[model samples]
Structures are given as structure tokens and as C-alpha cells.
Target: MAQSVLHRDPRVDFFRGAAFIIILIAHIPSNWVAQWIPARFGFSDATEMFVFMSGFAAGIAFGGTYRTAGFWLGTARIYFRAWQVYVANLLLFFFVLVLMLAANAWLYADTDYVTQLALNYFLDDTGRALLGLFSMTYVPNFFDILPMYIVVLLMVPVFMALSRIHPLAGYAGCLVLYAANYVFIFELPAEVSPDRDFRAWFFNPFAWQLLFFTGFAMSMGYLKLPRFRWWLAALCLALIAVGVVYSRYGLWSWSDTLSDLRGQLVDLRCQNWRGDGADRCYFWTKSNLDVVRILHFLAIAYLVVWALKGRERVLTMGWAQPILQCGRQSLPVFMFSMILSRVYNVLMDQTERTTWEEIAFNVVAVANLIAIAYLLGWLKSNPWRPHKPARTPAPEAQGQAQGGARWGNAVPAPGSAE
Candidate 1:
């Protein structure tokens, strides 16, 4: 009898789709009606979730490749993908620059010629072009992730080599790097001006690699220990409760008893601490990992995974399928979405920034995103291409059977070897 190829994990698709929805919805300005579910609960910042999941997905997709093809191949693949992203980003950057120039010319025709030229040259093209590529000093404009993605690609080989030793060891290294980021790098001198160091190190690929490693480690059976799921659920619930309490009651507020407790728990001085300072605020937003943020993100991730169990029918529904399709080809979808979002932002005037209008805009954005994803999926599943079975070596095949037995093949494995 021939073996059948198992289904790929729907959890990844569902989560990625959910992340897109969160990203879109979170960007909309909150209205009276929108306050029912706090944006913070859904997703206050979409970048972290996207980056973390990207790492996780890469781990699952690329780990076996690293094992079989060795580190160089794995590194090459990641770098190639990174290069693709960089090229796409550059294209978008130039496109946006041209659009900005045109918009300024048409909209601000009444302005003085010199003023218009300066605005076009300094603000529209030159400043933004520099900001987009290096992402060094300017505010984190759209498409900044391209540079960060390039950095992460460079580190993939290092991560692949480390992962082979022990998944936990790789995770430990990521954690140590994250901790160093908070202690040594995040804090800036109170008197000194903030510049590239503030933005670059805060968004440092080295520090943020922890979230990606966490995802990768989990996919590789690092979290497969007995009772681990239950423990994670419990921990997640507890942290959520704490987060709720912290949100409700200003834990760091000047109330007498609470202030004292907050002082003891977190050094207020840490906020002002520069290079040599030990005052570390637990909630500081660095591109690096913060303990609170990590826990918060993990709790949400666990909840999503737990909710996804035995829910394939729900995920495969009419509307749901489109999101899943987008999730399937996430990289292309992400790049496309970024381009569309930038274009939308540029075309819309300040009048469209109204709360209700923003909400409607997001709804349309998500709908179009889903449509794009579905179209891509349809294109990929071309009826013209006949399906073929993959060949496997006899010894390697036997090893798989034994390994499956060891793992107790309750869950169906995906069709691809990786």
C-alpha cells in the first residue's frame, strides 16, 4: 500500500491570517463603538507578531533543509529570500517617491516654486529614500522591515548551526542576546540626543531573533514535553490576568502603597539610566525582547493555537479560506500588502483620517488582502499541473517509519519531506 501525504498544520495558516486581521484592525483609530474590545488585547503592535511568526514558520519550513543540505544551503535560501524582499522594498520606495512628488506638484501648485522644490527634494525623495534603505536615523517609515529582514537572513546560518546542537541551546542563546539588549543597549543617556543607535539597536535583528527562535524551537518539538501545553495555557491565563490588573490599576501610579510596591519591583531610576545604569524598566519597548511583552505575546499565541485545535472546519470556511490562502503565501502577500497600504496612505488626504472612515478603510484593506491571497492560491493550484509523488531513499524511508513510531504518529505529517 502506498503512504498518503498528510495535511500541513492549519494552525500556522489560521494564526498568520489572524495576525493580518489584527494588523489591519489595530491601525484604525478607535471609535466609541470600537472601544468594546481594546486594540491592545487584539494587537497593539503588529510588527512583533509578524516577525515572530515569520521566524517560527521559517524554522518549520527550513529546519529539515538545514539538516539534510547542510548550513550553507539553508543560509543561501534565507539570504536569497532576503534579497528578494530588499529588491521589492526598493521598488516600492521609488514608486512611493514618484507618487509623492506628483501629489505635491498637483496639490501644492499654489505654493512658491522654491518652497515646492525644497519640499519635493528634501522631504519627499531624498530624505525618505535615505530613510527607506538604511533605516538608520529617520522615523521608522513603512518598508523598514526590509533592512531588518536582510539582517535576519544573515543570521539564519548561525541559527541553523546552533539549532542542530540542541533546540534549547539555540533558544537560550536568543534569550541571552535579548537580555543583553535591554541591559546594555536599550537605555539611552538622558542628556544625549537619540539617533540611529536608538532606532537600529532597538530594532536590532540580534535581539528580536528570540521571538523567531521561540517559534522555530516550538515547531521542532521543543515544546512537545508531556503536560507542557496545559502548563503553557495556565501560565498564559495568569499573565493575562496580571496584564488586566496592571491596565486597570496603574501599578506605577503615585498611590501610596502601590507606588512603594512598584518602586521595589521596578526601579524608577532605570528609565533615566544610560550606558552604565542598572535601572531597567520592565516595559521598555526595544526592538529587543522585553519580558512582559514576550509573555504577553506568548499568551496570545498559545490561546490562538489552543483555540485552533480540532477546528479545521471553522478555518476552511468561505471567508476563512481566503485568509488561509494569504497565510500560505505570506511573504508575497506581506510585500504586496505593504505596497498597497503605502499607496492607499499616500492617495488619501487628511480628511479620510476620521475614525469611522479609518475603520471602513481597514475593512476594505483586509477584504482586498484576502482577495489577493485567494487569487494567488488559485494560481498556485493550477489544474494543468499534474501532481507527482516524491522519491525517498530506502534507508531514509525506514528511518522515517521508525521515527514516526517513536513519536507515535497520531498527527498526520505534511506531504513534503521538510
Candidate 2:
């Protein structure tokens, strides 16, 4: 994909970091904070934001590799990053298992919530479950996102190659596969527990890939993110308002009895087929990348991009730097947060906490997440990567170096090596 150039963009980081935080809040079951996330107002939630930002970052990072080196090098870098994500997933799997087992042992040591948290397989059939975990077939309820990412990263080379030739062609392929998946219900295998049939992957890479590339392509300059328009924003917000009401009610099933005007809510049935309910309304489902979810996310992203256009500088301000730092170190922050959030989950479960206690727990967890981000940011400095080669020597030095041995009209002055 061809973005104008590789350069730091705080807007991306700012939102990326914000997405991680949103994911954390949402993942924590029963956390009141979850209600305020974008999902409450629209069909799409933090996951789209996370994946879009992932693709956006990837386009910038690997696009540079493709440009500086060549297609093969760029492809290799894509695989390498995929390998890293896979490794992180593996590490996370073990971490989750250990945390669950430890929590079980300490609390009650009697009844088990580890299974409640979806680790029954590990306890019942350790060997097969271990195999499934390694194969990425047995994803815990909350740990499936990484596997989706692993699949996406593995496909980046194909996206890059296609986009390099024709951006539309690449996205065309993604669109075809996504549509086919919806048509055929194509899915990667997943077995959360032995009792149930192997279920399809929750996120459906075949579908989510469309969103991923939409972001990558947008970032790569293949597709321009539409400039914010008042009509569009208002429409989006109006539809969002309808969604909010639907959420507040029971999908508007009760609206008919409300004795009030909720007619526009009916328009949400965008896929209504003749008189069929779906034809008239848009359904929002994450697995199939439903039109409602897709448009909701696009609208949200457009608003963010437009609103933050000239305000990028604020992300770096002291007040905003925590988010900026976390965004810059998204992967590590993400991994850390998942683990931390689980720990909080166990704590929430093991104790009878009051509302104040829950709020305090969330606050402390967020602070800890920020501190981890800070540490990750610091550790990422230089030592984690090989030192860059020094800049080319000056022309006069190059000439002298070519002369070798003794310098012109000069001899080795001391015992020190020349």
C-alpha cells in the first residue's frame, strides 16, 4: 500500500491507545464503565477501532520496508511480525492458564470459577487442551483477538502485493472473501470446550479482514478517508441515536407498545427483503462485519479524524501523554492489559465488592496499565533494536579512506592504531 510517506502521527497513536483502554473497560464484566464506550451509541465498538488502527500502523511500518528494500523483504517483514503476534498469543495463553489455576487454588480451593472463566478443558483434558491451545483451536472467551490478528498478519503480504499493483484489486479480494464467508458461513475452527461442537472463530478473519484492509488502504493513500460532512455526521449521529434507544429498550420490540413515535428506528432494518424484517433494517453483527457495524465505525473514525486534524499536538501534551505513550506501545500495552484485566476480573469475582470498591479497582487497574505503558515505552528505546548504521562518511573522509595505509603527507603519529 502507498501512504504518502512514513512519519509519526500522534492521531493514530492517540486513538490506538484509547482503543486499548476501551477494550479493557469493556472486557471487565459488570464494569459500569463499559456502558459509555462507542458500542453503546453505535453498532461497532472498540474492536473495530483496534483492528483499524492495527492496519493503519501496519501500512506505515511495512510499507516503508517494501519501499526501502523490495517486495520480498517487505513480505518477510510481514511474516516476522506475524510470528511475533503468534508468539505473544502463545505466551498469553500460558499466562491466562496460570492466572486462572492460581486463582482457583487460593480462593475457596473448593468450587472452581476457573472453569467458569472457560478453562475447564485444561483441568479435564490437559493434554488435548494444551494441543488445542498450541494450535489456536481452543480460544478462551476473552483471548480470541490475538488469534484473529495472527491470521491477519499472515495475510498482509498478499494485501501488500495486490495493493502495490492496484489498490482496488487487493480490497476486491478482501471483499470477495468477506462476502463469501457471509454467504457460506466460512469460519476458522475454534473449540472453547470439548462438550460443544467446534465453533467458528468469533471475529471471523475472512470478514474482519475487510475492515483491516480498509484501514490499511486508507492509511496507505490507496483510499482517502472521506472528509467529514455535516450531513453525513448528522445522519450518522441520528442513526446512532436510534441505536441508543434500541439498546435502551429491547431492540425496539417494546417500542410498538410504547404508544410513541419510534418509526425511524424501523429504518435500521436496512437489509429488509420486501416485507421481511431484515430487508428494512440493518443488522449489526461483528462476525459477518454487518453493514450497520461497518458504517458505524466509519462514521466514528471520520469524526475522530476530522475533529483531531489540527489538534494532533494535544495528544503530546502532558495531560494527554499517558494515552499517547500507551498508543505508541500498543501491542505490549494490549497484551499487558488483557492479563491485568483478567486479574481484576478474578478479584472482582472472589470478593463481594461494593460499587465504590469496583470503581476503585478499575481506577487502580487503569493506573497500573498506564505505568506498564510507560515502562514499555522506555524499554522500547534503542536497546530493543540493533543500532542503526552510522550515516555515510563525508566525501573527503571517503577519499582518504580509499587511499588506505598512510595519509597524504602524514604518517602514523603514535602507537595507537591509525
Candidate 3:
């Protein structure tokens, strides 16, 4: 048997990096950039791509360790990663809170930053709110994504263990958990509230795990992607077109007829899933990873995968370098972007927000994000560490190397390990 080797996939990083940019733009309130994000064109947005790519990365990072190094070591690695994400969440929350407070105190803005973010829970009951924040029970909407991500990472170990028993077992578990979300109405509490307002996290881990693990399985070779065919491509494109027409942010919102048709179809789907009085469900819901959203995203993913197949070299081009770099350092970039979005929102509120100002703001914001990503990448590389120069071979050693090469020994020369 041969040991498996892992190679870096630019496709994963490219898409993930692109997702970070979209997320950053979308988070900022009333940013003109938001109107042009991919969410405006389809039912799904960058969130799906981000989560799926994360799962693929995890599979490459940890799944192989589980198979070769055994389950315990892999589980430990997953725990460490989850801890890192958890700490990042805490830092991001505190940093954003400080930013909001500063904006409130220093800027004469009409919007109450604290109230806008629904951070009153902390001010009203500091002790309880602290407990909930630490326990992940008092998640504000802005900070909910990381909590959901942490929970999903923690689930990887369970699936990895199940996979050892039977390849399909873990997949079954994913489906069961996804189904349980709708059937049993299972979701983690996001806030401690007397009323039902904002009860659960904006993204439900159980429902969303399906997308993550699908990527995981595909990356780990437990599942295979469908073969690309002309018919399949056409089907996916058609589905995406339907999504565009059905999407409120898309063509459907422009005309009453399309809007009514979408509503009726959505209501029918909702009734089929949850009985007649299902709170009048819409075509897309972010919190539970609605089926329509899942389908639309999958269709897009299939098409994109095929369209970009064997063209991964494009990701290495100069134009794509910024996105590639951001994807390589996605975690730090994400945390930075989260805080940066708040800063942008505050600045926008303080400024005139005219056409020219909005254009300048978006351009500067993107430049800042790219700059931070490159800075983080450099820091993470630890350039401050002392470099050890390559050792020069002695005359005898050089002679031996020459002799080995003459005899076809296949010995690698100094500084030529690769």
C-alpha cells in the first residue's frame, strides 16, 4: 500500500477568498457594493461557498490525519482548530463592540450602533450576557456565523468516527441531523431572551452541516462529483435561471406576476415540508439553510466546478493573486473584514455617502482588505525568524555526490530537496 499525499488546491482557496470579499461587502450596512454582490443574482450567496470550501479544507487538513495517524490524533487536531475559531470569535466580538462604542461616543450619527447591533443584552445584564457569550448562548446576529462554524467543526470528529465503521454511516448521520432540524425544530439558542425575537443563531449548524460534509466527503474521496455533461450543464443553468427569477433580489422583485408566481410556488413547497400553516415560508431562508437555497447553490457549484475544470491555472494569474492570498489566510482575513465592515459602516454614516463618495469608499475598503490580507500573510510567515544558511559540502562529500551521480544512485544534491 502507498501513503496518500495532500496537495494544495488553488480552486478551494480562490473560491473561499472570493467568498470573504463578498461577505465583507454584504456585512456593511447600505454599502453600494452590496447591491452588486452575487446574492443579488441568485438564491444563495457567498455563505454557502465559504462553508463548503471550509469543509473541503478540513478534509484535506484533518481527514487524512484520521486515516493515517488514527482517530484520536485527528480529533485532537479538530479540537485545537475549533478552539482557535472560538478564540477568534471572542476577539472579534470584543473588538467590534469597542468599535461600536467608539462610533457612538465620537461620531454624531443618527443610528445607535449598540442598538442597531442588538448589543443591549450585554448592557442590560452584564453578568448573564457574559455567561451567554462565553457559552455561545448569547450570540448577536453579527457574531452568529463564527459560533455556527465552531459547532460544525466540532461535529467533524463524530462523522470521522462513524466513517471508520462504514463509509456511508457518516453521510447518513449528516442527513439525519439535517432532517432533524426541520422535523424536530432543533437549533442552538443564539440569545437569552424572554420573547421569541432572535431566538436562534442566524445559521443553524444542523441544517447547514449537510453542505459542509458534502464537500468533506468529496474531498476525502468518500463521494464523487457527478460527471460533467452538456445536458447536466444545461439543467444546472436552467435551475440557476429559475432561481434568478424566483429571487426577490433578482428579476422577480421587478414584476408583480413573477413575484406572485414565486410566492405561490414557495408556499406550496413550504406546505409540502411543514403543514398548511407554516408561517408562510418564503423562497429562501438563511438561518435553516432552506432547501431552495441548498438546491440553487448546488446547481451553481456543479456548473462552476465543470466550467473551471482544468483551468485552475487561471487562479495563479496576477489578477487573481489578491483573492488567492486572502483565501490562504482566510481566518485572519475574515476576522479583520468583520471589524473593517463596521468601520466602513460608521464612516459611511459620518460622510455624505454621495455617488462619488460611495465609489471611493468601496474602492478604499477593498484595497484595505487586500492590504490586511497580505500583511497577515507576511506576519504568519514569521519572517523575523532567523534563517539558517545552507551548509557547504566538504570536498570529500562533493566527490562522493559526483560519484553517486555517475553511478546513477539518484541522490539529491544539497539545496535540491524538492
Candidate 4:
């Protein structure tokens, strides 16, 4: 019998949506409401979850695409998608840059607008415009992930080729790269300049590639490691325990002997810290592979998969569908959410409240996010129902293309399907 795969994994969608929520909460300026939940619970940094899922989703999306479309066509599709992301990012950069300039001029007339403009050079129209067009590293902006995505897309051909020939060797290559990254790249001093002077150190593709390639390998059944659902549960518990210990008593030090050795090897400053054994708990938060974090996330992810197996109804209930929809079209949703977040930040800055009001602010923020998400969902469902332009296709089309024919067919056609 042919092996089966899930077209829409509720667990993945729920976790992805939850990740976005956490990211939103984290970005909310410190308020009493936000602080009520302890940061250690994983609310402080949701970026790791997002990035990891991005890789995981990439595996599910592109790996399937490669199988169906074959290597060359699959590579082209990925490149096109990456290029679309880059283009969208570029447009956003210019839009934000212009707004920032106008705000500086009109809003901060008394202050040194020129100085402010210069300081935000990367956020300026010309700088962002250049970065977007060329995919060059011009600024230390969080939005620069577009370039990284593009670079990773470029690697798809190589990854695909290796996967076709020897999936184990391909995955092993990814593992070796990850190991080298951990020992040499990640261990290097924080300030070590990449050849591009682009803080490639911070955005270490080598390390992140492991997550992406692992997803790819899994999709291809290259690494036939036993699927230990129960062990995954244990791993999750262990990670929680480690996180709790680290948060409570782990000491953070950047001057340890290990740091010195690492710093010397890489010719950069080293930050070494002693965690209460739990301090270094969340690997995703590190944005680099920490063995503990990697193992923990893997465990949690597998457990989630096991739990959600054959449970489709759980994903179809009440608000769950919309959230899953958001997860399905994650890239666009992410881009849209980022734009909304930046707008929210600007609005919050304008308000300038000193006190953190948790209940009130969170209530408003959550409501707005959900409302926006719902609106986006509605648009997705009914893109051409007379009011909206038929020009832009529903985000579901994008997901379908990535997932292949079966899943693609599941998406209701514009008017009749939903």
C-alpha cells in the first residue's frame, strides 16, 4: 500500500497560528496585562516557533512540489515564490520608509529630523529600495529575512538533487553542516563579521538549514528514525523541566573559558553564560540551534502530530478554521501581519502611555488581531464576490500549489467551493 500523508495537518496549523499570536503578544509594548503571564512560558520570543514552522512548512510544501513537478520545475516554482516574497517585502519597505520620513518631518519637527533620518538610514526609502531590489544586506532589520529565504530557495536545487540520489546522504550532509555551524559559526563571537559584513553571524543559514533540510528529509523518508510518539511526550516534559530550571536559577555568563576558546577560533567576542541548567532552555529563542531547544521542539512537534492523527474535526470547529486558514497561507499572512504590527507600533508610539494596562490593551489588541484575521479569512473565502478585485487570487491557491493536487483540489473554487 502507498504511504499516506496529511494534506492539512491541524496540529501544524494550530501551532503556527499560536506562534503568530505569541509573536503579537511579545511585540505589544510592556503592559501589566502582558506581564501577567510569565515570559518563561515562551511568550517573550515567538520568532523561533515561526522560523521553525516556516522550515517545516517549506518541507511539506516544496518537498511535495518537487515530487510532483520534478526537480527543475520544482526549483523554478520555489524560486518564483521566493521572488514574490522579495518583491512584496520591497514594496513594504518603501511604504514604511516613506511613512517614517513623513512622520519624522511632521511629527518630530522640533527634534533633529535629519539625524533621526540618518540613523534610520536602513529604514529610509533609498536604502530599503536598494536592499529590496538587490537582495543585499543593507540594514540590520528584522524584515531582512526575505534575502535569507531567497538564498535558501537557491539551495533547493542542490537539496533536491541530493535527496533524489541518496536521501540519507542528503540529510547527513545537512546534519554535518548543522554540526559545523554549531561548533564553528554559532560558537563564534557575536561581532564576527561575515564576508558580506551583513551580520550573517546572526542569520546563520548553516544552522537554520538544518531545520529546513530536516523537514525536507522527513518528507522524503530519508531519515527513517523511529517515530517515538511516547518518547516525544517525555522529551517535551523534560524540556519544560529544563526551561523552568533555567528561568529560576541558571546564571548567564559571556566570559567563560568556552566562550574564550570559541571567540579565539572565530576571532569574535564570545558570550558564555551558565544557565541554572534550565537557562538555555528554548533553542528557538536562541534563533540558533541549541541541542536542548532542537530536541525539545522536535519532541513537541511529534507529540502534536501523534495527538492530532485522524482528528480532523478538531480543526473545523468555531474559530479554529479561520486560524487554520491563517496558518495555511502563512507566508502572506505573516507579511500582512508584519505590516499590521508595524502600523500598530506606530500608533502605540503616538499614544505614548507609560503604564502597562494588561487587560484593556490585550483585549483591544487581541480583538483587533482576530478581527483582522477574520477579515482576511473572509477575503480569502470570497475574493471575487463583487466588492473585492478578482485580480488577486485567494491565498488558498498559493497553499494548494505548494501542497499538490489532492490538497489543492480541497480548496473550494472562488464562488462554488466554500
Candidate 5:
């Protein structure tokens, strides 16, 4: 990978930051704002965007290290990041659990918040659930993203090694794994149940890795995106329009009709499969990263690139700064948003679900995300480091320095002569 190819692009940050906001909205149940998110508009959503951007950023951040340093060093860095994400996941789960417990205790609400999150497994069998949680077995739906991410990060070195043999080799490996996901149905058990009724990780890393490595390959210069063209943009627009029409959230009057069509397709296609076939449309299976989602995301991503190509300056404008900053510190921002969404869900539950209340609550939630992004950025910058003022030379020293300059023996100030 060429170092030059790995330079930062502002558009990556812009889209990624925007996706974080969308994910926040989508996670909070009954938020009307979620209905208007891109997922509602199309097959793909922020989860795809998040995973793809993670791969792209990982390439930019670690690709050069693999090239300049040895393979072991690069692999070490990747695992260190995975460890960080693992810790964040644990922290988030416990914090949210505690929050819900406290709310349930004090609010006198009739909601069993733990059961709402499908965490009764933990309550019913703490020992088994704790073992499952740490071992990445009992991955609840809401908490699956980070576990998927951690597993993906661990696979980076494997792909990096394949890429060393040839770029095609790396992508071929990715495709094989992706296809094998369907053939083998490889997935982590999401429940710690003793019976045969077992659940699996929502975002299946084996299947989803195709998108991640696609972004990775592009970032590492193994794959190159075609420059924006008018005809291509038109095609992308047409695809997006089709996605909107076909999406479950589209066409209020056709919702039931579309639902039936999807159900028919799932029954026709998935029921006969040798492995476990989920009772839903395989074409829109978020867990499987179906082709429909892949194509939809590609179309949306290309059109976005076309829209931003000559107008890159817009990302640096006043209103875009908060989003850009959130992208820059995405891990912290995403973690904070996850924690914040729980509070928003609790508050929204108490409200009448009016338009004004929804708008107000969502606005406050976004504001909180932006504030945390900036705060985390500042903290990561090591702002508490002591600063030393430059010392002024004494009168005699100044005179000697002046004499040395005249006599061609003066040393230049640091970076002054560059």
C-alpha cells in the first residue's frame, strides 16, 4: 500500500459522522425520527455504513504500518484496537443494565426493562450469562455490533497476509468466506439456552466482512472506484428510487402488499435450504448482508461521492463541523450515543409521543452527541499536559547571541530555518 493512497478524505468523516447520528436515532424504539432515516428510504442503513467506514479507516490507520513495520507489529496493533472495543462493549452493557435497573426501581413503571432488551437470560442465569457475555456467546440484539466489529478486526491480519500474495487473493478469500457463510451458516450463538432453540449474532461477521474488506481494499488502493460520471449518477439514482419503493417503510398504502410479497419470496427461497432458514425475507436479511443491501449501499455511496466531488469545501463549513468532529472520534461518539439512547428511550416512554416532544427530544439527543464528541476529542488531545513558556535569554546571553550571528556562529531557532 502506498502511503500517498492512505491520506485522509473529509467525505469519509462526513458520511461516517452522519451515519452515527442515524444509528443513534434508529436504536431508540418508537422514535418517529427513525422512520425518516435512510434505512426507511432504502435496504441498507447506518450499520452497513458503520462497518464499511471502520474497514476504510482501519486501512488508512494501519495499512502503512504493515508496509513499514513487520507483520507482527501490524497484527498487534489490530488486536489492541479489538481489545479496546471489547472493553467498551463490556462497559456499555453493564452501564445500560444498571441504568435500566435503577429506572425500573424508582420510576414505578410497569415495564420490565431487562426483558425489553431481552436480557432476562442474564437475570435468570447469571453464571452462564456472564460466561457467555465474556466469551462472546450470548450476544443480545442491541449489543451485537461491537462483537461483530471485534471479530472483524481480528480477521484484518489474515486478509493483510492474503493481500501480500496478491490483491485478488485477498478479495477472493473475502468472497469465499462470504459465500461459505451461506453454505455453512457459520454464526456465534446469541443465547445460552440448553435447548435447540438458539439465536445467533444479528450482524453476522462472516457474511458482513465482504463489505468491510471492500472498503478496506479500496482504501489500500487494491481497488479503485471509478470517477463520478453523469450517466453513472443517473443509474445510481434509478437504483435508489427502486430501493425506496421496495423498502418496507415506503408507500404506506402498499406496506401490507409488500410484506406479503416478501413473505412469499422467503417461503419460496429459504424454507428448503439445508441449514436453518430464518422466518423472514432472506433478500433483506440484515444478519446475512444480502445482495440487495450491498447493491443499495453501493448506489447510495457512489451518488454521495458524485454529489461531493467538486464541493469538498462544504464539509468544512460551520454546520458540518460537529458531524466531522464526531467522525474523527467515532469510537467515543458511538459509545456515548449508545449510552445516551437508553436515556432518550426512557424519557420518550414517559411522553405522549407528540410531534413537538419527539422533535425536542431528538434535538437534545443530537446536541448531547455533538457535545460529547468535542469533549472526548479534547480529552484525547492530552489537554492537561503542562506547557512551559519559552525562556528569554539574559542581557549578556542576548548580546553574545547577536555577536555570534554577526560572526556567522548563531544557531537558528527550532523550525525557523526550515
Candidate 6:
């Protein structure tokens, strides 16, 4: 019922589905295929896609509620989802903690992924860490994104309220907040433990909110995708090519034919993109949501839309259907991918793998993920799934129910009798 609330959009689902798999591959640092993922060629990666898609989804799903139900009720529904996300995140925190501990004992004891995830505080100061987790202040590595989403969703009512008076009012605020964050390089201060020390949130809400609201505005018709002019198409293709090369060749562990050329671009990007603790090879930082990253995502999106403009059948094809299904079941599939990535990371750390081997592993991982998502999608579509019954309308109405009598006088049809 949750996923069914919105009018299904296949394109968004396909992109979301693809983003989850790409994210899984990217998260496993030990995998050679990580380099071949989209981030290397483009400034943006799966995070941008996921965030933007979520925003668009919110606009459609919650926006429908605003128009059909009441504004406050729709906003409340969105917040209800935020709570669901938070609860899921809490489960994930404990789940990852247990997985890491078991993995440490069972496989790579020396790896200590618990520390990498920032969960070691729980090991040393359980009481303090517990407080932080409950308060949404103690976010571990992959868990950080949920807190950001929860905070942003809390603002949807305010954003929608402001938009009613003036279209740009809420969006302008999003820009100013983003600019302030970039200039200050700030994150929501997070308490990792009971200690006085504070840590900045991994995904800066101020910066990320801009993208979310942008997607919302676009979906709601406050903004629209720029017209696909010839120049625009060219621009998108060129940028997509740049991203492809980096992902295909930029050094992670192996070198491809284009590595030399990609190496030069990375060097130029480092000087052009100034920052502290910078990694020259990575054109943009995931947390910062750099201009390049933003543009790259836009470019990729344009290309997808442009290419698939009239190609409706492509998504429905047997091979692509799994991805579309996964995209539709994004919340479950994302959680699945995250856990799977961690397990793969442990395996990669313990043994050596070649680029081809890593690619093969991803191939297998994807097949399994698709199977799981397909099954979940099937479950979601079950005829017996719980849902609210349709409300009966008032007796007085202009049109009859294809019968001679009005609603108040109508008798039940022969086969329809209860």
C-alpha cells in the first residue's frame, strides 16, 4: 500500500533501481569494479540519483495527498514516512553492528570494520552511544543519510506552505541555506557519544536539501526540465562521456586504456576544485555535493530522458523489468544492497580479486539482488495485500451508475448481491 500510493512512474523506478546497484558496488572499497562505477567519470554518483529520485517521489506521492486530501494530512503522511525511515535506520544500525562483529570474529578479525563504521563508541561507551542513537545523533557510516532525510522531510510542510504564496519563496530559501553551508562548510553537529565532543553530519542537510527541493519543484511543475535543445543534448552527452571514462579507467586498482587520459583530468580537477583533505582523483566529495556533481547528474538524467523519450517498451523488456521492479521496491532493495555491500566488503578485504573477478562478483550480486527484488515486488502486488476501502459517495449525483435509477433508489445488480 505504501509504494502503491503514488501513480507509478517507470523511469524514476528504473533510475532508482540502477542507483541502488551502483551504490552497492561503490560502497565495497575492496572491489576492483568500484573504479569502473559511474563516480570515476562523473562528479556525481548514486547518492545524487537517490536523493533526487526521492525528492521527485515525495513531490508526486505527497503532492497528490495535498491536492486530494488536506495539506496538513499530506504533510503528516510524509512525516509518518520519515518516522518509518528512522525506525528502519535504527534496525540497520544494530544489524550492521552485529554483522560487523560476527564478520570480525568469523572472517577478517584484523579488519575492524566496526571502527570504520564509527560504531566503536558503542563498544567502549554503550550507554552514551545508545543515547546518541536514540536521539538520531550517533550515525554510523552508511546510516548517516537517513538522519538527513528525516530532517528534510520534517521541512516539507513548511516548504509546501511557503510555495503557495510564491513559487520561489521556498526554493530561494533552499539556495541561501545551501550557499551558507558551502561557504561555512558546515554539517549538523552530531554527538557521537556522551562526551562533549561533536561530529558534523556525514551528509550535510543544508547542502543536500537544495537538490531535494529542486526535484520537488520540478515534479510539481514549479520548475521543469530544461528543453532538450540540440546544444543541451550535446552538452549532456559530452558530460556523460567524461563520467564514463573516469569510471571505466580512473585508477582504483587496475588500469584501462583510458587511464592515462583520465589521470590528467583528475589532476586538473584537483587544482580547479580546491578543498582541504582533498583526494585529487575524486573530482567531487560526496558530502559536499559539488557543482560538478550536480551538473553531472543533471546531464545523465537528461540523456536518459532524451534517449528513452519514446522508447517506452525498453523498460518493459524482460531484462530491464527486474531493474524497474527493484526501483519500485527501493526502500527494501536499498537496505538489502547496503547489507550485501558490507558482506562483500569483508570478503574483498580478506582475499585478492582482479578487475574481471570483481566485475564477475558484481554480476552475480546483481542477479541475486534482482531475484530478491522481483520476489518482493511480487509480494507487494499480491491481491490480498491490505488497503483502505474506497469511500462511498453522496447519494445525490449528476450521473447514474449506468442504470435507470439514482443511487438512493438503485437496487443491487443480480450478481453484485452480497
| lDDT (Cα atoms) of all candidates against the true structure | 0.55, 0.69, 0.77, 0.53, 0.76, 0.70
lDDT tens digits, residues 88-197, model 4?
Answer: 76776666556656666666334342343233444345544454345454533445555556556667678778767776777777788777654444432222223323
Off by over 4 Å in 1: 1-6, 27-39, 42-44, 106-139, 186-202, 223-234, 245-283, 346-355, 382-418
Clashing pairs in 3: none
Model 4 TM-score, 2 decimals: 0.70
lDDT (Cα, tens digit) per residue for candidate 2, span 319-408: 888887778787788998888888887787666767777888888888889999898767756576888975443322322222111111
Say which candidate scores most in TM-score: 3
- Give the per-residue lDDT of model 1 (tens digit) for 302-390: 67655654565576678677767767877667766765554445333444467676566666777888888888777877857887775
* lDDT of each residue in 326-377, candidate 5, tens digit only: 8878787888888888889888878787988988999999999999989887
Residue runs of model 2 more than 4 Å from their true location after superposition: 1-7, 108-111, 192-195, 248-284, 382-418
Choose 5 or 6, whichever is better by TM-score: 5
Candidate 3 wrong stretches, greater than 4 Å = 1-7, 195-198, 253-260, 272-284, 388-418
Q: State the lDDT of candidate 6 residue by residue for 1-418, as single tens digits.
A: 2212212456667778999898888877667777667666766878998898878766655665565566888777888888988898888878988999998788844678887776777888888778878897777667888888888888888888888889778888888887776555666667665455766777878788888888777666667667669998898888777666555354333556466666675667667344665454432466767777788888888777667766755776787888887787767788888888887777666656767667777887788788889888677667586777754432311111211121112222111110
List the RMSD of every prediction in angstroms. Answer: 6.1, 10.4, 7.9, 8.0, 10.1, 8.8
What order do candidates take by lDDT, descending? 3, 5, 6, 2, 1, 4
Query: Which runs in model 4 stand beyond 4 Å of their true positions?
Result: 1-7, 29-39, 42-45, 105-119, 123-133, 183-198, 224-226, 229-232, 248-287, 310-312, 350-359, 380-418
Q: Using lDDT as the measure, which candidate wins?
A: 3
Residue 42 of model 6, lDDT score: 65
